[model samples]
Structures are given as C-alpha cells and as structure tokens.
Target: MSDDPLPFLDGPWRLSMGLRRLEPDDWLRVDDAHDAQMRLRDRLLAERRAEVAAALPGSEAGCAETLALLLEFLPERFPERWTRDGQVMVDRRNGRRVALDGEPPLVIAGRLVQEDLCLMRKGPDGYELSAAVLCFPSHWRLAEKLGRPMAGIHAPVPAFGERLGPTVDRFMAGLDADRPVWRVNWSITETDELFLPGDRAQRAFDPAEPVGSGLFLRLERQTLRRLPQSGDILFTIHTSVRPLGDAIVRPDHAAALAARIREMPERMSRYKGFHLMGMPLLAWLDRLAAAQVRVAAPG
Candidate 1:
C-alpha cells in the first residue's frame, strides 16, 4: 500500500546495520491510508487486546512518558494532517478523529498512530521490554516477548549473538532523548498478510510462480529513542508488505534485491525464511535480467 516501490532495496542485505540519527520532523511517516490503517489496528486491538497490548506493573513511568511524547510529537511531525487542538485529535490525512479526554495509553497510541510502541527499561541484565502495543507483527507473538530482555527476544535471529548483540547493547544504553536512530530489515514471504504470527501458517504461499505472483516483500522501518523522564528507550516498528512482482517496475530494484538475496549468508537466509524461497526468487530475477539484456540489444 506504500507508493515506495523499493522500500527495502537499500543495496546489499540490510540487517541490523545502520543506526542513523533521526530528526524530530522524521520521527513518524504518515504514508497513505493512515486512518484506515488506524481503524484496522483498533479492530485488532478490540479482538486481541490481551494478545497485542501489554504492560508491566513497574512499566507505568516509561509508558506514561511514551504516551506524552506521542501526544506532542504526532501533530508536530505532521502538522497539516495530524492536529491535536482543544479536546479533539484529528487525522485529516485519513479523515479520522478521536477525543483527548480519557483514552487509555495503548488505545490512544493504537488509534492515533500507525507504528507499534514498545517501552524498553534498563535493568541489571540490560534493556527489557516493559510494555508494547503491537498490531502488525511479522511472525512473532507479542505476549511471549513481554518483559524479556533484548537478547532473549532476538534469540531466534541467527548470528545476532555473535555478530550484533554487543553492538545493540551498547546502542540501547547510549541512546539519548535528543538523538533518535533507525534501521531497516527485509524479508521475502510467501504471503502478503501483514499480521502473520509465527504460530500460523502463511496462507499466501504459492507453489506455482512462487516468486512471480506469490512473493511479497516485508520491510520493517524500526526506530529507537530514549524517553526523557524514565530514561527508558522507546522502540517503534513500522511494517510494510507489498508484492515483489508488482514492485519490480524498474530493473534496478529487482537487481538490488536479487544481489542481496544471492549473497546473503546461509544462517541469515534461514533466519529470514529466505532459504525456502531463495531459488524461486533468484529464477524470477534471472528472467528479468535476461529480458533486460534483450531489450538493450541493438536492432
């Protein structure tokens, strides 16, 4: 649904690689259909409130701090569309509005924004997830991850321990309120579903032309910022899923994705669920490459 054709086509294998700083203006992206997305999020909240939203008894301060930030940041970042004036918060971009009087933090967060909110507090063992309101999970269960430290939550990710674990610890500890940073990750899936939990099978997987019509590119635009009051870091995850076959309008996007998948390590391929889908994807890219060569040939 994002008009961004090549959202994850950032050169080779984008992992937990870049932690570039984010300006206040860039805190959130108000892509198309914000209201509809928020409505979908609210429905998910109503149906799976206990599953998608959670908070610890000791998570009050950090959750409150994060809620405050969203109240002030949403309108500031998207002035034209997101306005919080008087007793009403209006999202003109999506043509949706909500009152400001007595909504719960998770409800307000879920209704007003698209990005899932997670509060991370630093304890003896490092940063642990204190609270979260995640509606669009790629394949992980939010209830199972609550109160766990960063390393525990990421245990399934291959090479995260030896490769990016220490670096992530340092980053979380050193992150400041004045400086927010973000990184991107890419996964090719058999389905286009946005709410695929690890427990459920992907209904979008197609054996025929798996890479052509069945493949979807799922990209997560993740950001981190330290809460001014609680000193806890707030992690935000924004997920986008679009058809790869449709997105490869230009040759370069396909070429970049092909190169990244072609060279990705075996461990990472397994972790990303790419190993099963790799050969078909490569074949699709190969066809595109061969077609381009033919187009470029002289008459």
Candidate 2:
C-alpha cells in the first residue's frame, strides 16, 4: 500500500516541472474497489457513450496507434490479469470487458472507466486536443475543451500562464515516447461519485453541509507520452478516490493536508472551488488531526 495520501496536497505547493519517469508496472491500478468503480464506468459509458467518446479525423490514426500500443503494453505488464491476442487485449480477470473492434478512440477510451483518455496532435496551432474520452471529469466538460489548445483548456484557472503555462508547454514539447513522464494532481471532492462532468460537477468541501463534508480526495495520476509512430501525444488520467477518514488511518495525512489546504492562495482556491468551503474544509481537517493524536496517546 502506498503511504502517501492526497499526494499532490500532502506538501507545499510549488511551481516547477514536477514530473517522473513512469515504469511499466505503475501504468494502471485495479484495486479492491475495482468492481464498484467499474459498474459506475459501465453505466456512464452506456448512458453517455456517444457524448463522452469522440474524436476528430486528425486523431484517428493516433487513437488506433495508441490502442495497439496499450493492447501490447497491458498484457506484457500485468501478465496475471491481462493477455494479448493479435490486435485484441483481454482482461483475464474479466474486469474491464471491452470489445477491441469499432472506433479506435472508443475501444481505447473504454479500456478503463476510471481512467479518462485524451489525444493531442501538433497542428499549425501547436498541440490541440484532437480527441478525448473523459468519463470521470473532475468539473469540466469535454465539449468545452474539445479542439482547444493548452491556453483555452486552462482558461478557468486564474493566472495559469504565470504559474504553469510556460513550464507545461516546454514539458510537452520535449516529452519522449520511449521514456514517458507522469505526475499527480489531487483535489477534495464532496461526493464519492466518479463521473462528474460540466459546471455543476465541481465538488464542494463545506463542513456546514454534512453532505459535502465526506471529503473523498480525488487524485489523478496523469501520464504523457508522444506516440513513436504518429508523433502525437497520448495523455492518460487514472483517477483514484478514497475517503479522507480512511486516508488519515495512515499517519500524518491529516496534519499535512490541513496545512496544505490552509496555505492555498486566492487564485488556486477559486479555481479549485475551494473559495466556497476552504475554511470549513480546514476546520474538518483539524478535527481529524486531533482525533489522530487522541488515538495515538497512551491509554
């Protein structure tokens, strides 16, 4: 079990190229919550299949190429639960039952519901989002972001250019397909629901509202790689959600998260939807910290 809880928020926020080389084994995580999470994924895919999954003509080649690579990569990486046969990859565990035929983006996108898939291609306008299957979006819409460049994609984030614009642009430009890079981002969500899209999707973190105080930390393990054959970027977002209460079971999480949340600047708070519940969220974290101390005391 990983010790780090709320990994992106467990430390002081900093502006830097905080990326790492991703190993084969770390590509996907199918945990104890696999069945329940997959049910939700299946439901979303069934209900909004056409809406959630689509791609432009420019992205078709990359999507097919990406699917081929994933089919090869998964079985080779997790031999116990996954296996590849010709152009198809089968989940030996029968977990993510997906047909390998049909649209390349849909087949690849439906590989795992917990993970959202996006493809970017370098056009006259630099890298643009050519295709995406974003089933578990945090608080944004795929329709709004489709075909948009990095700047338009991050328009909601205040002063993003000064903070992360230049750094991310350079990172993507230099990203290598052979050696993929990965990073983590975390946010506190009021609901445990995985597939929250559109403007109403941002989770509130107020203690005043009992419904919003559950505090399931949403973490996205995002990976970036430029496809060797297509020269397109393949970005995968694998989301993991765990109750804050459960996370505090591992030592130091509560105190660290409390400090980190309290120190968030105004621009960040607004973008993360923390302005509505930042104080209440901090208070709740403090209570969790006190409970931890009480449990550890000599009794």
Candidate 3:
C-alpha cells in the first residue's frame, strides 16, 4: 500500500542471502522518516554510545576511510538533502550540521546518514567485524559482535553455520571494490522501535487474539562495498519499520505474505519469533486476504 516497494509481499520465505548488484549511487537511502530516525540516532549516540558503537584497536584507519567515503558519496548522491561546505556537511532534512571533527569518524558518518556503518577487515582467520556505529540493530548487540569473525558474529542466526557460513566468507573475501552488492531482510516485531539491541523473550499469543493491528514489518536494506583505501569491506544497514496492516492492503500481497509465513521452516519461525504469534497471525492475514478479494471483485 505504501509508495515504497514491499519485498516481503513477494516472497516464498526461504533462508538464503538473496544478494543483488548495487549501483554506487544507491548505497544510502533517505525517506520521509529520515528526520525522525536521525533524531533517534542522535539520542542513541548521546545516551548509549558504548552499546551502539565499537571499534577495535587497529580499526581506526578503516573507520576514517569509511567516513571519508560517506562524506564524498552523500552530497553527490542526494545533493538536495545534503550539502558540503569545507569540513562541515549540512543535512537539509533536520538542519543538522556535522563536522569532520569531534566524535570518531565512523560515528560522525553514522550521524550523517540513517544507515549504520560497519567495517569488516580480513584477519588471520577471515574477515572480522572491526568497527561499527550500529544504532538500529534489530536484536543484536554491537559490542558482542565487535572483533568477531563472520561465523562467530553470525553464530546466533539459525542454520547460518550449516547453510551460508562458507558461502558468505567466500563472497566477502571475493567482493570487488568497484562492484558493490546489496541484500534485504525482513522481520516481524511487536513494536516499531528502531534501537532494539536485546532479544525479546518468546511470548504466547491466544489463537483468538487479534495479531495484525499492532504488529510491524521491519526491513533492513543492507549494502556491502570494499573500501578502496582501507581494503576493508564497508557494510551499511538502513532499517525501516512500517505497520503490518499498511503493508498488506492488496489481496495478492496479503496472500503472498501468508504463503511465505506458512512455508517458513520451524526453526526459522522460532528464531524470528513467529512462534509467538502462532496461528492467529496467519488467520488474521487470511481474513484480510479474503476481504481484499471481495472488495476488489467486479460488481
């Protein structure tokens, strides 16, 4: 229903990376919620900086390079919303001016855009998370992942080790500096809060309870490019949350989402907390699909 394309509505719900080639200009995104999300990022940086950001000892160069790349990219990508005058870049959305000084360069870069910036550098074992300014983590802590290799960082994700670990490592190691790629992932949550760092305990939902109205569809638009100067991969995640009700207004979308949810593996369902909603969520979606079909039927 929204103007933005809904990937979740076009899904069969399998566990795969689903990566696509990305244009250099589309690395970062801005939307109507930019100002509000930027305000939230500012609050998180001020109040919970340690929790949302971390940099290993040797990561300063990569972090600085990431910042410099963003400084060059932002104004060129969206000149109407971003302007650079000397060391200061002004964000027209919120009228916030960010300078090259003060906070760590990666932190400054995070402040300038909605995407959480992360640097992954190759270590003795493989690529490790070297530095990151992650304010809108879905349910993972930045501190726990810092200085960890790809497998260790993704250990919590179900089937990641068995299914995609080696593939991911190979992809990251082989990623070209000029050829960046991107992927998207979706999650269902009870709230629309952006700064979620801790996992929610599994809760029970009654079969008769209404599960559609209050839920949110959280989307992560993730991009990966190797930083030319640092030789470290720059990973960016731009998170967007929208009401589930608003996303499934069309009959086809509602049916497609319901089918995807039904086809999801049990382990993944539990991992994604879909087990919390149980059958009620599916039933609600089915009803919506039927209602939409009737409304769209010819007279």
Candidate 4:
C-alpha cells in the first residue's frame, strides 16, 4: 500500500494513458500463459493453506481461515492500499493474468518467472525497464516485498563484475561528465545463457554467418562470474552505465542507439575463447563510435 509508485515508474505521478493494442493470437497466447500461471499459483496457495491447517487441525488455522489471515494481514500491513475483495482481480487484456489497477503503487501479480530486479519510468517514448532481470528478483528485499519467500535459500556468490559487461563499462568510461545519461535496463536474453552456441537457437539476431547487426550480444570469455548451476545464465546489464544521454534525442537517434545495442549480441558471438569474454569491449567501442558518427553527421 505504498503511495509511492515512484520507485516503480520513476518521476512525477502520471498514468499510462496510452492503450497498447495486441493481436488476437497474441492475446490468446498471453491468456493461456496467464491462466496456467494462476492455476499453479492458486494450487500453491491451497497447499500452503492446507499445510498450516494440518499443523493446527482443529484450531483456528483452517484452510479458509489461513487464507483469511493472509488477506487480512496484507490489508493491515498495507492499510488503505491493500484492500480485500474481488475488486483486485487478474488482468485478462492480453490473455495474461497479471494484476491491474489504476491507483498509485500499481498492483502486479506475477510469480518469479525470471530473475533480476529493475525499475522503469514513463517517458515521452514509452515505458522501459530491464529486459534481463525483468523476469526475476534481483535482490531479496524485492522478493520479500512480492511475497516471494527465499528464506534459507542458499544463493551462490555472484561472479566477478556481474554488474555490466566490459563493453558497457567502456561506454561509461568514455562519457563526458556533462552528458545526461539515462540509467535504463535493456533486455538481452529470452531465457538466460549468453549464447546458444549454434545456429538452431531461438536468438534475437539474424542467423546469417558473420553475424549481422542486431540487438543480441554474446560473450565468449568468463565475462560472468558466480553463476548458479541450476538456473539459466541470467545476467545483469547493471544500472551504473548510462544508456541514454540528454541532448533531446530525436526519434532517429533513439532508434540508432537501440539498434547499436541490439547488434551487440551478433558482433560479440564472433569471438572465441578468451576473446569472447573481452569481446564486449568491442561492443562498447561500437556504441561510442556510432554516437560520434551521429554527432558529426550533417542534419
């Protein structure tokens, strides 16, 4: 019930007035996925309630009672924000079961489908958040906030420089202090792992040899450290690097920036062995070089 949705959509309070349209097929597919997730979530909730009930068989901790407790507890903790009742139901707009409401501190209902925590704010362009960690909780505080219990969960130590790839670091290093950089997260992988290592993978870039310009980025070195054995090779693009600069970027400039970043995956894939890890350095160089090109070009 935090009145501050500021953390989620940075800057002043404003609504996302734009209506995003989705095709019927897209809607159906999203709805199916949402439904499946909700079913599983409800099942998990029921099991938890039953477990609590069994612990206190004839006591007040019955199945229905525990659910009531959860509902009651959330509202009490959140006060006016977290109200009970069916008013706050799952959204079925795109055939997905995400939570929806128009009030401040938007209510979102999603299980930990991916790892990584990111915050996005509305801009002249649209809503943008980290594509990588958008699916997963980056830190424990966020996980707890979303009711994702991670207690007693032994997390492996993070690998070295999990923040940003070498290329990104170099980009930041090249920026002038006066440049207004926007700390934004860009999505790279669909399901984790830097590269699929073969042509058969469902990559974001074109499959043509000598990889063409695309948004995908692949690293060949030990660019990532402390990766978990069980989970996918999820990475963090890091918040430190300023992906955007002031200068009132025109649409063309924005598109150019986006395309340059997208093409990183392809160029990065060409490297082998140690060269692969350090390959991101090339990506960084490419972005900086492109920015220079844009500035020097005659309008």
- Give the TM-scores of the predictions, in the order they appear: 0.90, 0.86, 0.94, 0.24
For each candidate in turn, give its C-alpha RMSD to the true structure in angstroms: 2.5, 3.1, 2.0, 17.0
Against the correct fold, how does model 4 do in TM-score?
0.24
Better of 2 and 4 by lDDT: 2
Q: Write the per-residue lDDT of candidate 1 for residues 162-234, one digit (tens) a residue.
A: 7888888998888878988876666777777767657534243344765766877777788899888889898
Best by lDDT: 3
Candidate 4 runs further than 4 Å off: 1-88, 95-108, 111-274, 277-299
Order the candidate numbers by lDDT, best to worst: 3, 1, 2, 4
Of candidate 1, the 10-residue stretch with the lowest lDDT total is 198-207
Lowest summed lDDT over 10 consecutive residues: which window, candidate 4?
218-227
- Model 1 Cα shift for residue 196 (angstroms): 1.9
Could you tell me the lDDT of residue 34 within candidate 4?
36
Rank candidates by TM-score, best first. 3, 1, 2, 4
**Residues 98-141 of candidate 4: C-alpha lDDT, one tens digit per residue:** 23333211112222121121222122322222112222222222
Question: 1 or 2: which has the higher lDDT?
Answer: 1
| Candidate 1 RMSD to the real structure | 2.5
The whole-model C-alpha lDDT of candidate 3 against the native structure comes to 0.85
Candidate 2, residues 1-299, lDDT tens digits: the string is: 13333565436865455688878667666666666767776676678876677788878789878777767666676788776565455667865456676646555556543567889988665688988877788878888888988877887877777778877787778888788878888787777777777564454554566423366777788888889999999888877777766655543666787776667787777777677667776676677668878888999
How far out, in Å, is residue 79 in model 2?
2.0
